[model samples]
Target chain A: MTRIEEAIKQSKFQDVYQKALVNLIYTANCLRDEQVRILKPFDLLPQHFNVMRILRGRHPKPVCPGEIKEVMLDKANDLTRLLDKLERKGLIQRNLCPTNRRKMDITLTQAGIELLEKMNHMMEQTHETLKGRLSEREAASLSHLLDKLRG
Target chain B: MTRIEEAIKQSKFQDVYQKALVNLIYTANCLRDEQVRILKPFDLLPQHFNVMRILRGRHPKPVCPGEIKEVMLDKANDLTRLLDKLERKGLIQRNLCPTNRRKMDITLTQAGIELLEKMNHMMEQTHETLKGRLSEREAASLSHLLDKLRG
Candidate 1:
């Protein structure tokens, strides 16, 4: 068993604050692990999924690399390199923004949309699997607490 | 403002979830950012800090890389590389076990312990800075929900 698993098994604290740090890191790792497994079949990483989602959000309206960077979940400094890899895979397109020569506009290719559609059910399943562990009320409270924690 | 900061201001639910994902990523990034900052003065990453803590837990008894992997929060597949990095920095030393040539025993050097000692208070400060936004009770609840969500 992992140290985190062991920590969970042995934890005596009813108050979560007592071990909030470990718990947050542990849970995020678990969520990311699940995402990695599902995304692997598509030859994508979590960062790639993040970029694709952002593109899809701005569908019909092209966005620049700077905008993508502002919204990226990982805020990777190496996004240009990551986008280069995605562009190489034909999952996305990069075009020069006519208005701003310095900015490169990014959009999802047809292949990228199809890939996201195919993975929709898997994404739902991943959330459903986790949702089973907590009630709706619990989930909302969790989300709320997380937001508050970030304040 | 960050994408998440803007998303929160816009109150976009779909954008909110996307931002929430980014928030989690950013929060983790921030914590790691602080950790890195604290560790830089000592020339260590959080992973290195973890290794030192593990070694201290089993002081006087050398641990193998495999044992360290089991207890590691990250459980990195590249432990060999991580160990190599630490060993290169003189924070840790490796000796082949008498019974198992395939396994090497790892122990902390005096420099490693002193480094950890110097940064111990700083580590607590890292947690304090993060918890500054939430009450103790809220932090505890957040931790609990995160753990339950992982299950």
Candidate 2:
């Protein structure tokens, strides 16, 4: 209780549901912040890592900016500048999609994949460490509850 | 599975904890989007609501910008502009601190409290609706797992 209470510096929430919402958001931010810190070594922001991850997941395949935007975790933010930066860094390639000439297809370069793979194990280890406090059953329950929360 | 899967357009995750992290973040964003929608009517963003709620909680006690930033959920974001906006809107007041002449004290105006009270029932209904899917036990379990995850 003190961990979270102290993290946000406020013990009392408006109510249980509100408390849960804040906890969920706060914890997610903590996770995001950790990722951001980890990514800082690579001179990348969380949103930048997010795009790289999306492109990496689509490896050997190509996606357009719109497609990346569609699935982005931080949709409120615009990714044009980040894309431009990644493109300049030679971590990503942007070209006219053959299928849709008007659409710009964003693809991860070899360097990008290498970079992501370089960070993959560390990220997995971090996630495992961050999640180590909960048992498998608790992790499953947390996922289930979160899925149900949106419905 | 289709809900979260389809929203992100990716089906399988590498592991359960990873899946849970994604789910937690996705659901928190979902909750945030809902709050944004509700807050739209009031022309207030979630961060703004957060500040108002914070100031309202400290009623009769003036707080400085540093104090508010210390407790803000999205502290990474600069609050000076937000404070400026709220001040311009007459929802919040900022003045020189009597105790610390160099520091600025921020507080909610009467209209701010009124505005918050006006939305209180609606916000509670939103939370109630969001929490409706889970039982109290499940909600408690979700909160507990999150706390443990951060431990």
Q: Model 1: residues >4 Å from true position, as ranges? A: A1-18, B1-10, B14-23
In order of appearance, the predictions have TM-scores of 0.88, 0.92
Best by lDDT: 2
Report, for candidate 1, the interface RMSD: 4.0
What is the alpha-carbon lDDT for the whole of candidate 2? 0.83
List of chain B TM-scores, one per candidate = 0.81, 0.92
Q: Could you list the CA RMSD of all candidates, in the order they appear?
A: 3.1, 2.1
In the range A73-122, model 1's lDDT, one tens digit per residue, is 56788999999988999989999999989999899999988988887678
Question: What's each prediction's clash count?
Answer: 1, 0
Chain A TM-score of each candidate structure, as shown: 0.89, 0.90
Residue pairs that clash (backbone atoms under 3 angstroms), model 1: A17-B140
Candidate 2: which stretches are off by over 4 Å?
Answer: B1-3
Tens-place lDDT per residue, model 2, A1-151, is 3356787888786666777778898888878888887888888887888899999888878898888998987683667888998988899999889888989888999999898887776787787686668777888888888878877
Q: How do the residues B22-135 of candidate 2 rate in per-residue lDDT, one tens digit apiece? A: 888888787788888888999889999989988988896888888898888878367889899899989998999988898999999999899999777678787778767888
